[model samples]
Structures are given as structure tokens and as C-alpha cells.
Target: MQLEQILRERKEDKDILLMTHIVLGYPSFEANREIIRQMVENGVDCIEMQIPFSEPMADGPVILKANQDSLAAGTTVEQCLEFGAEMAATYDIPFLFMTYYNIIFKYGEEQFFARAKAAGIKGFIVPDVPPEMGTTFLKEAEKTDIAPILIYAPTSTPERMTHLDSIAQGFIYCVARRGVTGKKSEFGEGFNDYLALCRKSTRLPIAVGFGIQDKDDIKALTGRADIAVIGSQTIRLVDEHGPDAVGPFIAGLR
Candidate 1:
């Protein structure tokens, strides 16, 4: 099934489907493969694999360090694709790739899309690419049945949000804060208002990310979103306790 269908079927009245992110080459290719396997076994509905880049402008300190470590260990984009294809062959979950525009440009858009489609990738999240580009990559992605997910921050104006809603497919990533990706404070008083605004603008699935750490936050976010994306927290868990801790961490969220 598609990512959207899986999310809809898994979602409960107060339960949001969990979508987790991890750097694909973090530490090493083998480690990354094991991490993906563990996350799937831990009940992650969708997996966002971040390909390591020399300059990850949108990433925060934690992710940047992880990327650096992965690159230093000799993990490349090709390895990430091979690993993803291996996982896709066995798992039925959606595999989405998150990367900067430069990587796609360097690899050639058509080449990237063709390889990703052959490898069973389901979607793309290019945060650095704006709608104005409107390149052939977008068209090819649609043709290949790969959805391009978009991100919108909390500080986005209504006009921008509406525009994003129109172009976004599969899901809209609602950044919990205005900063780069990392952990942060709890959802404040205006959280619901922000969610309400997104709901008003989009019919696609809405998933919240950034600073979502524990069960309390998940419980507080119940009914506010269709998916709860926990990235930094899951990465932290993998870093501190290996992939074995992912299952219990997910259980805590539920």
C-alpha cells in the first residue's frame, strides 16, 4: 500500500501514526541498515532516510555530527540506495528520502529519480528546493508514482501555507518550531492554533515534527495531527543505546 493508505489504516481516534527519521549513512552503512530494520520492527509507519551531504544546511548539530560521522566512515549515496532497496524488498513500509537540492543536482535529477524508483523509494523531501524551480524532477516523480512531501514551519504566513497546501502531496510536514531540526521545549499554548491553521489549508495528511520527545508530548498531540514524526529523539535513542531501545521507546509513545 501507499504511505497515505498505511497511515490512514493505522491511525486511531487518539493515536497518531509514528514516522521516524534517521541519517542513512550515520556511523556506517551496516549500522544504518540495522537501524532501519530495528525501526521497522519497532512500529514506525514511515521511514525518512536522510542522505549525508557535505554541507547539510538545514540540519542541526546532532544531525550534522551524525552526517559527518557517517561520511567519515565511507558511506555514500549509492550505498544508501542499495541498503534501502534491500530493506524495501523485505519490508512493506514506505521509504522516503530526505536530502538537499545540491545532492539531486549533483547526481542529475533523472538519474536520481530512476534509481530511487527502481530501489522502491516511495517519496521525496527536498527541503531546500522551492516550488518556483518547477523542474523536470517534479514531473518525473509524479510520473513514477513517487510523492514529494513538503515542509512548512510554524512561522509560515497563511498565504504561504495555502500555497504549500496546493503543491504538497502525500503529507505536509508541520515543523514544530522555527529552528533547524532538533529537540526543544514542549508544545505551547498556540500549538493548537497552528494545527488548526494547517487543517484549514490542507486535505492531505499532516504530520508534526521537531521537539516531539516523549509520551506526554504525544498524548498532548493526540487528535492534533495524523502523524507524529520523532526524529531527534529516535536518533538519540539509537546513538545512546543502540537499535535495541527503539521498540521500548516506541512503546512509550503509544
Candidate 2:
């Protein structure tokens, strides 16, 4: 099934769904494989396997460091793609390829799309490639059955959100705050208003990411958002603890 359909169907059983992001080959693909297993076994609904890049603009320190470290350690795009295929084949949950547009441009857009499709990847989260700049990327996404995940920021106007929804497929990744990933998010009045606009903007499921950590954060997104994304925190957990720490942490979120 398509990612949107899978996410929508998953929501029938749970009030909120969980999606996680991991920088492939951070510690190592060995650890990455294990991390994905723990996440999947502990009820993670979807996972975005980030192909590490040199300059990850959307990331904060933790993820930025991971990206740099992964690249420095000789992590290649082919390795990440192979790891993604392995995870998708092993886990029943939908897997997405998240990376910068430069990686796609260097790899050849349609070739990347074809490779991702062959790898069993269900979606692409190229944050740098907005629909306005990604005509071929969007078209290839449609043709290859890969969903091009669009993002909406807290500062986005209602009109802009509507425009995003027009070209967006799969789901809308609603960034919880104005900044990049890592810092913990505090859900309050402003967040509720932003979420309201997010809901009003798209028919696709809205996934609230950037600084979403711990059960309380997940609880806060319960009815308001369809999916709560866990990014840097998981990388932090793996760095601080080990791959085993992921399963228990994930199980307690809902």
C-alpha cells in the first residue's frame, strides 16, 4: 500500500502514530540495522532513513554532528540506499528516504526515484526540494509511486499551507517550531494555533516533528496530529546508551 493509505489505516487503531528519523550509518549500519529492529518491534509506524549529507541545514547540533560524522566515516549514498532496502524488506512499516536535494541532483533524479522504488522505499523527504523547485522530482515521484513529503513550518501562512497541499503527496511534515531539529518542544497556546492551521491546510495526515521527545510530548500531540516524529532524540539515545535503549523508549511513548 501507499504511505498515505498505510498511515491513515494505522490511525484507525491508535489515536496517534509514531514516525522516527535516523541518520543511516551514524554509529554504523550495524547499529542502524539493530536500531530499526527495536523501533519496528516496539510499534513504530514508519521510519525515515536519512541519507547523510555534508551540509544538513534543517538539522540542529545533534543531527548535524551525526550527518558530519557519518560522512566523515565514509558513509556513502549507496550504503544508505542498501540499508534502506534491507530495513524495508525486514519491517512491515513504511520506510522513507530523507536527504538533501544536492544528493538527489548528484545521483540523477529519476535514477534516485527508480532506485528508491526498487528498494521498497515508500516516500521521499527531500526537505530542500520545495515543489516550486522540484518539478521533475515531483513528477518522478508521481510516476514511480513514491510520495513526495512536503513540509509546513510554524511561520507558514494559511495561503502557503494551502499551496503546499496542492502539490504534496503522502503526508505533510508540520515542523513544531520555527527552528531546526534537536531542542525539546513545549506544546502550548501558540503550538495549538499552529496545529490548527496545519490541520486546516491539508487533507493528508500531519506529522509534527522537530524536538518532539518523551511520552508527554507524544501525549500532547494525541488528537491534534496524526504522527509524532522522533528524530534527534533517538540519535541521542543511541549515542548515549546503545541500540537496545531504543525499543523501551519507543514503547513508552504511547
Candidate 3:
């Protein structure tokens, strides 16, 4: 409930909240530090830090390349945990670790949960771990007070949403389209209906992710979704323009 309460309280003023994603060591930890400082300074509600998995299956080309490069550069789970702790303690916003389930499995679920809790991480978004396969993962998360965030795709049945809602905490990540992240998502009648199903199925705040780009996109989500997540675009901004470009880009989103 810590994360849920934070969002509810923060949402009292803003029509919609912003959440950003970063691969921990993509440019460099130094660049990560500067980017996060700017993000928090500019009023980002929360941030999800991806721990760079070799096979980030749900990600599009941009993020997939970041993960591969970070791993090739020898980024380790310990470094990510340390960085997470630093960010959480230094910034007021919530931080979540978004990675593949294999990372957790290899690190040992109990230890990962314990370390993440100690690091002050508020949630986990392991994209590939469905509830059926995540029984132990979810259990450890609950015991450690870490929200186990679950994803809902457009194809998910009403039954699937209900099942996911029963287990998810913090919020439900509603993938804006049928595919992976990066490509622009067109919001149409079908999209609205999909968001409606997401809202109806989960008491948790609905955060719409994949391909949410600028202010218009954020405006589009304002009433329909509680949080609008920005992922690959930010990474692209950092890559093309450098980490310093993140602040203005994020500021312009609202």
C-alpha cells in the first residue's frame, strides 16, 4: 500500500502522473545519476530502472540494445541494487526495478526481494513472469513489502484482468498496443475500450506504457489513465542528445 498511497496522494493535483524508465548503465552510472537528478527536479512522479537483462523479451529494439550493451559492459545485479538504493535515498519519488524473471531467479528470489526492500525499491516489473510462474516471486514480494506489478495486454480476456488485479499492487501496466515497446501507439476507439477494461478490472491505478511519447500523448491519457509511462524515447534522447537533454524533454511532456 505504500506505493498505492503515494500515487493516490500525488494524483490529487496532477490529472495524470509521469513515470520514466532507464537502463541503469546504458550511458554510464555517471550519466544515470545526472539524468535521475534532472527527472526528479522536473517533477517526475516515479521512475523504473531496468537492470539490463541479456534477453529483455518484451522490449523493442532501442531498449533491447541498451540491455545487451549494459551486460556487455559488465553491469551486474549488485551494481544495479547499489544504484537503486542511491537513487531511492536521494530522490523523493518511488523507484522500481524492471527486468527479466531470470535475473531474479538467478539472484535468488528471497535475497533479491530482501535486498530490493533494503534498497527502498517500491515495486518490481518482471515482464516475462506471469502469476502462474511467479508464485514464489509474488510471495517473496509480499513478505518484503515490494509491489509485484503485472502487465495487461490488449488481448487479455476479462478473466485474465481479474486474475491479475487480484495479485498486482502499486498499479497495473497497460501495454498501449499489441506489440513490444518503441513504435508509436495510435489511440483510437479500441484503445479506449481496452483502457476501460483495465480500469474496470483493477482497483489499482492504471499506468499506460508502450510508446507514450509527448505532451499530447500525456494529455490523451490524463483522464483515462492514472500514470503515463515514458520508456524508450527517453533512452533515445539520452543516446542522441546526451543525458542532459532528458530534463527539458521530460519537462515538455507535461
Residue clash pairs of candidate 3: none
lDDT of 2 at 43: 97
TM-score of 1: 0.94
lDDT of 1 at 235: 80
lDDT of each: 0.82, 0.93, 0.94
TM for every model, in the order presented, reads 0.94, 0.99, 0.99
lDDT-superior candidate, 1 or 2: 2
- Deviation from native of the Cα of residue 14 in model 2, angstroms: 0.6
Task: Count clashing pairs, candidate 1.
Answer: 0
- Kindly report which residue stretches of model 1 are placed more than 4 angstroms away from their true locations once superposed: 12-14
> Tens digits of per-residue lDDT for model 1 on 124-184?
9888888769567678777777888888787888899899888777899988887787857
* Error of model 1, residue 248, in angstroms: 1.6
- Residues 115-181 of candidate 3 have per-residue lDDT tens digits of 9999999999999999998899989988998999999999999999999999999999999998899
Clash pairs for candidate 1: none
